[model samples]
Each structure stands twice: as C-alpha cells, then as structure tokens.
Target: MTNPAAAALIARSNRLGADPKNTNYAGGNTSAKGVETDPVTGEPVELLWVKGSGGDLGTLTEPGLAVLRLDRMRSLVDVYPGIDREDEMVAAFDYCLHGKGGAAPSIDTAMHGLVDAAHVDHLHPDSGIAIATAADGEALTKEIFGDRVVWVPWRRPGFQLGLDIAEIKHRNPQAIGCILGGHGITAWGDTSEEAEAHSLMIIDTAADYIAENSRAEPFGPALEGYAALPPAERRARAAALAPTIRGIASADRPMVGHYTDSDEVLDFLAHAEHPRLAALGTSCPDHFLRTKVKPLVLDLPPTAPVEESLARLHDLAVAYREDYQAYYDRHATPDSPAIRGKDPLIVLVPGVGMFSFGKDKQTARVAGEFYVNAINVMRGAEGLSSYQPIDETEKFRIEYWALEEAKLQRMPKPKPLATRVALVTGAASGIGRATAQKLAAEGACVVIADLSLEKAQEAAREIGGADVAVGVQVDVSDEAAVQAAVDAAVLAFGGVDLVVNNAGLSLSRSLMETTEQDWDLQHDVMAKGSFLVAKATAKVMIEQQLGGDIVYISSKNAIFAGPNNVAYGAAKADQAHQVRLLAAELGEHGIKVNGVNPDGVVQGSGIFASGWGANRAAVYGVEEEDLGKFYAQRTILRREVLPDHIANAVFVLCGPELTHTTGLHIPVDAGVAAAFLR
Candidate 1:
C-alpha cells in the first residue's frame, strides 16, 4: 500500500494539472514500492514501495504494489537478454512476493532497480514537459534547482535508456532526480513520501509558471482561403509542396502539423520577401546542431513549372552544401574531423510552417522544439529581425573543441587573464586614445604610451585610473625611450601582455615625386619604431616565459597599390609581413602576432583629420564631408570603419582565448577587400 503522504503528494500533482497524456494515450497505471534485502545475510529484510507502471499516483492503493526480491530484480537486467523474452522477462519476478500480486515493472525498472535509496516515485508531469520543450531548458533547470537536479537530453525509454540513466547516477551520486527531455522525471529518496513530496513541489512550481506565462493568443487570424480546402486536399498540397523545400521532403510530417488557416500564412504567400520565414525558424543553438545554419524557404507560384521547382530545390541544397564546404575549408585545422553528415536540420515551406528532421524520434523532437522556440524568440524580439548565424570559422572551432569538451567535465572558474593589460602608442588622442578607451571597457588595463608628456597625463586623467590604467610618455621611435617604458611596465604591474604599434607618420607623394628624406622618415617612424618596441618587449617576455601579443596598425593602401602615399604604404606593408614572420618564430614561445588595416578612423584622431584634409583638397577638390561620404560609399557594407572597430580587432588578437590564432591580418574595413576585388 502507498504511504498516505505519497498519496497526498500525487493528489496535489494532479490538482496542479501536471499530468500529460500517457505515452500510449491511455489511462496508465502508477505504483510505488521499496525493495530491501540483507546483503550479508542473503535474506529478505524489509519491503519498500515503488510506483507501478499502469497505476495513477493521485488515487493509489496498497493493492497496486509490485513485489520482487530487490537483489534478484537488480541482477535480472545484466542477464535478461540471454533468456528468451517469453520465459525470462516476466517469469523471474515470480520468485519474490509481497502483499498484493506483482504487475510488470516500469519500463525504467532497471534504472530504479539500480538505485540504493529506499523510496522512489516517477511521474509524467506537464511542467517538466514544458521546460524540456523550451530552448536553453537545461540551463533554466540548473538556474531553478541548482545542483539537486540532473538533466539529460531526450533519449528513448527502454533498457538502453535505463543504462544511460545508470551512468549519470553513478557520476552524480547526490542528484535527486533527472529532467529527461521530451519525457517526464524520476525522483527518488529514502522515503516514498519524501520522494513524492519533492516531485509534487517541483511540478506544481513549473505548472504555475507555465500558467502565468503562457501565450495562448493567436499570432494571426484564420484565413478563409486555407479553410476552404478539404482536409485531404490540404494534406496532399502540403506533401506535394514539401519537396520544393531543400531537406524538407525527408522530414516526418510535423506532428503538430502546419498552420493551414492563418492570416500570416496567406500574407506570406502573397509576397516574394519571405526569406525571413527560414531565418525565423532558427532561434537557438540546439537547432544549429540539428538543422545546420540556414534553411531553404520555398514559395512557388501556381504556374511555375514542376521541373523548374524541383531543379531549383536541388540547386539550393547543392549551393548550401558548397558554401558549408568552403567555410569548413577556410576555418578547419589539420586536426579537425571530417564532415559528420549532409542534411539540413530544418526547412521553411513558405506559406506553411517549419519542418525539422533528425535521425530518430528523440533527435527529431529536439530539433522541432528548438525550431519552435527560435521562431517564438525571433517573433518576440522586435518582430522578426534577421538572424546572423555564426561564421564557418566559429562553427568549426565549436565543433572540434576537444579542450572545451574536456573542460565540461569539471567546474569552471575565472582566470587571471580574463582581463588584459594593453600598451598603446600615441594614445594621448586620436586612434591611440580611442583604442585605449575601447580596451579598458572590455576588461583591460590601458597604459597610454605616447611621446607628448602633457597630453598623456591629461588623457590618462580623463580616462580615469579605476581600471588599473596609467599614462607613460615614451617616444616609440627612440630606443632609450622604448626601453624605459618596458622597464616601467615591469615595475608597475609585473608584466605587460598586449602592445599596439599605432605611433607613425604618413607622407603622401607619388613615387617619382618622393625624396630619399621622405622615405627614411616614414620607415623610421612606422617600421623601425614597431620593431624596437617589439624587440624590447620580447626580451622581457622570454625571461618571464609569459608570452604576449603585438598588433601593428597598418593601412588599406598597403594591400591596394596607390599613386601617392608610396612611402607610407610600403612601410605599412613591411610592418604587416614582419608580424607574420614574428608569429611563426615566436609561436613556439607562446606569443601571438597580428595586424589590422582600418580604412576611415576619424572622430578622435588628428591623423585622420590631417590626412583627410590634405587628400580631399588635393585629390577630389572637395571638402572633408564629401570625402567621408565618398570613402563610406566605396565599401561593400557601405559603412565607415571606426577606431573602436580597429581596437576591437586588436583586443581579439591579444585575448588569451585566441591562443591558437597567429600570423593573421584582419581587415576592419567593412568588406572593403570585396569591394576592391569587384
């Protein structure tokens, strides 16, 4: 017989509306029993109660109990497959008996059998289902329950599933229960009442939550056009239309099915601008694992040729695959694994709902849940803004992150290098000043390295010192001044990790109009000065064995040959190549090297104003505003690059998180290279 407290808790669970339809859509049985045996004596000890599979806990009775020898039941799983299912599966349970007759054990009986606790209870709660169906549900569970609960993504319920739960139980001996995705939960305790009480509390809390936040309002009104079609006609139309969407034909028809009579669907069908339907279908990271990045949006006119539609779908899928391959090729390392499989995780059928595919029922459910959550979030966040999927490089890093996988096994902690210490040349104002400010905001200490003593002091005062930042006047072009700055850095903060070589002069003149004096001045300030600082910093770093980062601020003109500014371009180009060589030689020593080529970094910098004032007057015979517009329009993204953007690139290079990256030049010019190529 069930304990009175367990019975009450089950009643509360049902009152809270925590029960969902059983897996077979029938009234299912539930029971609670305990198994106790004296290991040393090899004799029956005490009978513990557990919930039976077919009984409902809300009105449980003692007669619903299933009795078995705890030791015998536990051993059966290890040897069950060896015996024929007809004789061995249910026949073995007859050896042990308690008050009432024994019924077939829960499908998860093996899992319950392995637990040493006295009392156990299991329930199919609606709250658990709702949380499991949401995006980032595992994280949400952790937030609510702390470490008391363990979460396992959806898996089939059977013998193999029981083994999986056993493994988790072994790993987390203290876990009270696990939230199984697309399924319910299993809560266990020393007393049946305690187990059932906790289960009731959790489900009640979740059900209350869902009730409070549920959005039952329709997204749009029903449409007469779709409602006019017969059910058979609608099903046929959906199936015939499915193949037109790449990767959609293979997916199971949506279990919840598509919206046949919604105003949103009708409006979508009327317009050619429905690519957003696919973008809206992706709202969470889980979907990416299932669906790849983007899905095809199918919107075919009634008069369109069937052959053309089929060919278009095939072509779209092939193109997407090719793009994926190109991204992998560009970002994948030699140690990277081969592509796992080729199939889109989700597909958008224009005027219809989204379709999600997976290899199995559990995977399919996960994909579908992710798709729905993503669509909801996208809809909620400012009415369906476009989603920018992570680039191929980032995806490859995530997919092949062995170190990250290893780290997941342990608890995480904050590191000392979580914040950076940066030294910026000519940082009193202009690009240097802007770069220093940007770095500090991103959890970095800024040392304003400049030649002007007064300006450095003033800039430092303005930027503040709470962030562990200061100003040091040092002529980077001067060897003694550079050495003094390095010594000051070591004395002030034990070490420095990032150096930005931004101090330089630009002299614009055609090659034929250039003088030897102009060429020497440009090289000394840009090339030689960068080398001097790097060499001094390298000596200090090698001794301390604390590798660092160095970023040279080059120019877009370095990549594209121009008529004038030959000296500046040549010097900048040399600085870039020098960074690559430094990266190769110093990589083993744990130092990274990179460069940034920014196009139009105006605002705070005197360099941009000075260079632009001269260039606009001489080249375009126009004012500065017109020149800014001209440069901004020349870029493919049609945006002017800012000093903050360049600083961001430099910060990325200096970050310890990017340890594997080196010998790279990131152009922070808003797709200027693509424009130049065109």
Candidate 2:
C-alpha cells in the first residue's frame, strides 16, 4: 500500500476491468515496472508488479499482485529452453521474486516483464477479440490501425510469446500496440495513464470500424419463428426446464445454476447464424473455460409444449454427453488431464434464454456473461467477413493444459453445503432467521421467504450478499405463492435441495375462547402452509433427480396436552403428522422429511411478542416479562430454549450427518418429559 507505483497500477487495472466491453471477468493482466528499495542491499532495484493468476483486475489489490525482479525475469530469455519447454518457465518465475511474492506469478508475466515500456496491459476486449479472430485479422488490423498498431500471429501464451511481442515492439519503433492474432490485444506505454489511454483507443477504433463495416443483418436476419417469447412466458418455460437441465449438467458433480434472459442472449438465439456459430464454440481462452467447448442448444422453440420439450430434453442431454466425450477423446493426449466433465456448462433454449451451471452461483453467472461476450465477438466477426478462430486442437491444448490443471488443484475445497440451495420460510426473524444464518454459514445459498419482503431482504443482506442468500415474500398458505417461491429459488440457484417449514403463528386460547377463524388461521399458516411448501419444492427436487430435505418446525404442544392452547396445539399436531407422512411417501425420491419440537422459544419469538407470551402468562398466573423464566423452571433441564437452539436442531436434521435418518423429530426443548415422543 505504501508504494505509489503499485497504487497507480491497481487504479489503472480497475479502470480497464470495470467495463464488460474492455474484458471478461478475471480475463486480463496489467503490470507496472518501478524502482523499489531492496531491503537487504539498501539500494534501488527495478521490479515488475503484475496482476497474479486467477485475480480479477477490477477488484485487484496489492496482495493480489506478483512482484518480481526485472533483471531476473529478462535473464530467462538467454537460458530460454525454446517454445517446446516454454511452460517450464512459469516455475522459474519463483526464483525471480523480489521478496515473498505477494501471489503466484501468471504465464503472462513474461509478456509484461519483457516489454520495454514501463506499463503494460493485455486484455480480452470483445472488439479486440472480434478482429483477432477474423479470417483476415492481420489485414484488418493494418486497415483499422495503420502504422501505429501492428499485428502479431497467434501463439499460446508463454515465455516464447513474450519474446515474440518484445521482438515486434523493438522492430516497429513507431507502433504503440498490436492486435494479437486469434487472441486479443496488448498495449504498452511509459506511464500508467498512457497505457490505459492506448488500450481504450485500440478498443474504440476496432469497435468503430466493425460498426461501420458490419452487414445490415450481422447474424443474417433474425429467424421468423426464433424471436423471443413474451417475458412471462419465457421465464415460465425456463423455470420448468431448469431443473432437468441442471440435473443432467450435474451428472458428474452437483452444480448451482444461474439464468439470464438478457436482450443479448435472446437476440443471438433468434438469429439464423446462431446455430452454426454456436456449434463452432467460443475463441477466447477465458470464455470457453467457463462455458465449455460449446453450449447445449435445444432444437425446439420456446413455445413448444412443456411435456414434449421435456421428453426431447432427456434425449438431447444423452447426445450432448456423448459428443463431449468424443471431443475429449479426439484431442486428449495420453498425458492430458482426465476429461474434466462431460456435461455442458451452458444450456441454450431458443426464445427462452440461457441457463448456466457452475460450482456456485457467482461462477454460474459469470459463465453466462462470458458466453454473451462470445456472442458479441461472433457478431463482429461475421459482419466484417467470416468468423474464424483458432483450430479445435489449440483450444483443447489450452483447456487441458498442465498449468490450467495446476490452477484447479490449487483452489480451496468446497464447504459441506457448497452447492446446496435451501429455502427457509419465515426467515425474516426468530427461528427462521437463525436457521438461515446457520445454513448460509455452512455454505448453502438460501432463499429467505417470509410474509414481509423488506424484513426478509434485510435478513438476507445480513447473512451475505445475493450470492449466499436472496429474499422472497410469500404467503405459504397460498399455493400459488408457495409455487412462485419455489420458482424463484430455481431461477436464482438452479433448484432447491433443502426446505425449512418454520413459518407459524400462535394464539394461546382455551377451548371456550377459540373460534373457527382462530383454528383456520393457525392451521392454514402452519399445517396447510407446510404442506404447500413441501409440495412445491418436492416437484423441483424430483425434477432435479437430486435428493432433498424438508424439516418442519413443529411444537412440543403437538404431543403434550397444554391448557389454553387448543387451536395452536391442533395445528402443531397436524404439522407433526405431516413429517411422518411425507417421509413415508417421499422416501422413494430420496427426500428426507423431519421435524423439530421446541417447548417455548420466547426470547426471539415473534409469536411470543405478538400477545401469545402475555396470554400464556395470564393463564399461568405469571407476569408477561417473567413468562420465559417461568417456562424454563417448569422444564426438567431448567434451561431456556432460544431460537438458535431450534436452528441448530434444523441443521443437524437436514445436514449430511443425518443422511440415513428420516421421519425423525428432534427435541430442542431443554428436556420436556411430558412432551417426550412415545
């Protein structure tokens, strides 16, 4: 943080990375060469500070940069083992670290260090890549940039590529940058400001040239029947198909999903050239790494019948897997990394939109964005002339490269609930909120469903941002609302793997005081609501072909005959029975149904604060403020039951530890002898 040069480099990297037009997420590297005091020698030494491997420039920090001695980096050229052994040079970078290198050096370190300029930027801008991937990219570069910018033929990024660029820069003294054939662009300057300006200039010039020369219909005129469907219809169709697609995509491993219905995706899918262009796949290394070689595009249009489409989807999935395996077999060397996965990360349905899957929500979302960038590149290339990219063999070389495999191995292991998505009803406060927090902490992406949207969103924000948790308002008793909540979960993170039926209200009243409305309200929210929520989520779970969990937050009153709790007790009893019934019926689908019985969670109970505490206190001849203590004293354990205790029980019942346990009711009520299950 103390180094001004590093601060300026971070600023410049962030500015260039902030826009999708400049580069895809985590797709570029920037560097600044500056003089730093050598701690041991007390003399100034020249150092290169470059964005490290796997770091996103927009969020780059000092710690995310790799610092190395310039002299050591340049010296590698003399001993360079040639292009065949270029990959080994990456390991050699360690010896050049100025100190404990802040982060692992990237393959592009040589490109940044070898260049004579004080600042350098190598980015994958959509416009730059369009020209780079065009059939006559070298010729187009000359026409668009003239003498100021040159062209470098395609070469896999490595120490050899560094030498190539440096040699080009040295020979062309008048050039400021070059359009890299079938890759992207690299620009350099004496200062960070000059480097950024030059980068922006090349990107803008390429974009303007493409715009002016583009055909009237870049994608060969949108197909008549392929136009996007209505927004509501599109979402409805996407929701229906998402689970099946996700299940197929997750065949190798469980994956979270993200859906995007942006105009870009829709427009691309509707075009005539989309099928052919999509078949060719993306050109950029960053784009295909996330999107896979090619997406699985549905042959049917969006308006097709759901059942018919579902039937076809299964067949297409089988074909896609087989094709992916064939691609791997054709290009994989004996030493190539084991085929990563046969499933397509992206699924494209004409008229509907795109559904992308990944190990987590953010990754899934980014994959979709990368695909969109690919779409733009394709549009520009087709408009200018013919869309051409590096051959399939080269793509396979990079995709299964040893260095890429090493990077994957370096990633941290996933958490227990890493890819699991949970929907917790009544999550705005009390037991529901506690349960949501605990689930999120364990790495589950949660949907905080409650009657109050504002409160639910507040709770979600507190748990984590949209990636970890999202908020949705629902009246669980309303079947439509319950279905909508499930749909939201599927759209947000593919499908639900866990359901917590914690939404409830209590009215402490004697038989004489209880009315029909009181009974109906209690049963509707707790009993009927639980059934509705279970029914909706179960459909999705079934479609996903992935086992799921449903835990009902029942009450001790379900078993214990407490006075002045007629309607509330009946509702609890109904919910308790549902746990056993659902467990029996849903067992075939691997869905475990369970329940939790808490005696009296008064401390953070919304029910307690909403008159139930005072009513129960009046019935027991105790002050409302002393009600919690009074209940605790009556319990065998003589301890208060709080919301978190209920939450802990929920976690255990739904978590992996109890995978073989189902139709079980956990008691977290400080030993209530009277309520003990027989």
Q: For residues 1-678, what per-residue lDDT tens digits would candidate 2 score against the true structure? A: 447778899999999999889999999899999998999999999999999999999899999999999999999998899888899999999999988749899999999999999999999999999999999999999999998899999898899889999999999988889998888999999999999999999999999999999988788877878889999988988899999989988988999999999998999999888889999999888989899979998888777899988888889889999998999999988989999998989999999999999999899999999999999999999899888988898899999999999999989988878899999999998899999999998889999999999999999999988988999999999999998889998999999999999999989888999999999999999999999999999999999998999999999999999999999999999999999999999999999999999988888778899999999999999999998899899999899998889989988987778899999999888999999999
Residue 38 alpha-carbon offset, candidate 1, angstroms: 59
Task: Give me the displacement of residue 225 in model 2, in angstroms.
Answer: 1.8
Q: Where is the poorest 10-residue window by lDDT in model 2?
A: 1-10
Error of 2 at 189 (Å): 0.2
Instruction: Return the lDDT, model 2, position 256.
Output: 96
Off by over 4 Å in 2: none
Which candidate ranks first by lDDT, i.e. highest? 2
Each candidate's number of clashing pairs is 22, 0
Question: What TM-score would each prediction reach against the true structure?
Answer: 0.39, 0.98
